[model samples]
Target: MKPGQQDNMREDIYQEIQKQKAMSREKEAVGKLAGRIMHDFNNVIGAIEGYAALISSETADPVVREDAEQIRAICAKASRLTKELRNIAAPWEPESESRSSETTAVLSDKKVSCKILLVEDEDSLRKASTRILSKVGYQVFEAENAEQAFEIFKKENPDILFTDIVMPGKSGTELARELKDSKPRLKVLFTSGYVNEKGKIEEINSNTGLFIHKPYDYEALMKMIGGLCAEAQA
Candidate 1:
């Protein structure tokens, strides 16, 4: 090869190595942070859960029992947050517990009247998620896959759409482009248990907001939705 060509190839290899190193370093840092958080949360959650269980076993007083129940509820919320963060901190690993005790902390005191389009291939996950979201006051429209999601998007014109990244047919990213073409301001949230080489959602447009990873807790999910929708409205 010519001297110029050889130099160019060398530079390319060096750049690639640097990029890989950076990615590795970032992953290590994230993993460390996740471990620390999980450790701390486990201690807190265990104590609270244990105490709640004890209180429930012994207490006959309604007020005290109610307080213990409240403690248990708070602990549950913390546990969900910990799990979701752990998921974000490590994309490759899977969480066994399918259920997430996540809640949408609606920003506004007034009614949160926003339409939601949910596109997911997994039947049980879809149904469970739809139920959870609907119960939380989000008017959710369901789609088994991205194709159906698109049809529903046009028909429904939902404020925010949530979809799975990995699908048998059209991927969520492709569907996102189509949806944005028609509804330019439409908000999107992409979730995936399996991420690509880029981590979670591939072909991410920087202009687009957050891409929520799969196994996200209700709190994290709602926070994203609230922030994105709120930004759109603003």
Candidate 2:
């Protein structure tokens, strides 16, 4: 090739490489923003759903119960939209067959007798999950972040650790690892709305830990907890 032609070809390649790098950086920024937004949005949905559940259960009036049910239905729809946003932010393949089975296991009316340590940075989401679990006869202890969670874990020695993956200081996976070092058989169930932590999530699943996406309904959450409790007993 002519020297002039060679020089132009090299410049074109370098520009293309720079363009790709810029696109990658932009994608990362968008994903981080989406993760933050989804985390907050899911917490709101969880709070609304929890309140609706309370209304449905406490009210004897059929009309009130119907309204509460409608609210839950709307939350479910909103949850799906958040899930779509997650996909757009960081697309990934669907859950493995084993993981799918764990989440969709057949639920039972049988009361679970187990202590649960629920850790989440989001206050509303943590409280909602705690209330929902407590209502169903599970002994739930909640903490706003991993620091408090560690204290609770030391005292409670909970049967299962239900935590959000990405917290402010210590991530849920980090807490779980530290706790598991002391108690190897400790069952863990991680939750998150941020798809950016897909790597951490996959690592958790591969290590025999459980995970449920954020904005999950009461039934789905129960299914995961029930399955973990059963495994704990076994």
Candidate 3:
């Protein structure tokens, strides 16, 4: 191999390696973004499913029930699609409940009246989830970030804290920990889009069932709320 020819080949190889590295970085960035997006998507789905469930429960008309059922079916399909997208971006272990398409019936004929402090950095999702939660008979307080959530938590002293795990500042887990120290009985529902390396949702304490994945259905949310509230009040 001539010196000049060998030098040129080496340069070509270096450039190719750099190019591959750039592509890999880009993929990683996109995957993280997709995971975040999937989380927000779940919030939207939760709102949609919640509203539909409210309608289904309120209306006596068969046609209205049918319409609500159709809406739920579409939301269920969307939830599945987002799951696939999130998996492509960052594959993680899913809970058995997360895989199921079946929606549970409302826990009781009467809506459980409770106060919720909803903390989410995503504005669209924050508004959507709050609206649906309020529509379904819960008093909901909104916060844009952990700081705001802290302020709201101080003032409202809500029964439950429904917060996104990843937030702008002082993550949901941090907020939950601080608040729980002050109010040990405060029921918390921690939600997240991305899973840790271990393929498990991070639990703040022994309350294993307190964690909920994104794009959750209305029934599941309600069930969680009811159970948490009951525990808190107990």
Which one wins on TM-score? 2
State the TM-score for model 2: 0.88
In lDDT terms, how accurate is model 1?
Answer: 0.66
TM-score for all models, in order of appearance = 0.55, 0.88, 0.74
lDDT of model 3, residue 10: 99
Worst 10 residues of 2 by lDDT: 96-105
How do the residues 1-234 of candidate 2 rate in per-residue lDDT, one tens digit apiece? 999999999999999999999999999998889888987898888788777776776678999988887888788788778777877887772341121112112222346789999998778777877877887788999899889988898898899999888788998888888889888889988777764755785668665677777776666678778888988999
Cα displacement (angstroms), candidate 2, residue 26, comes to: 1.4
lDDT of every model, 2 decimals = 0.66, 0.78, 0.73
Winner of 1 and 2 under TM-score: 2
The TM-score that candidate 1 achieves is: 0.55
- Residue pairs clashing in model 2 are none
- Comparing 1 with 3 on lDDT, the higher-scoring candidate is 3
Minimum summed lDDT over a 10-residue window in model 3 is located at: 96-105
What overall lDDT, based on C-alpha atoms, would model 3 receive against the true structure? 0.73
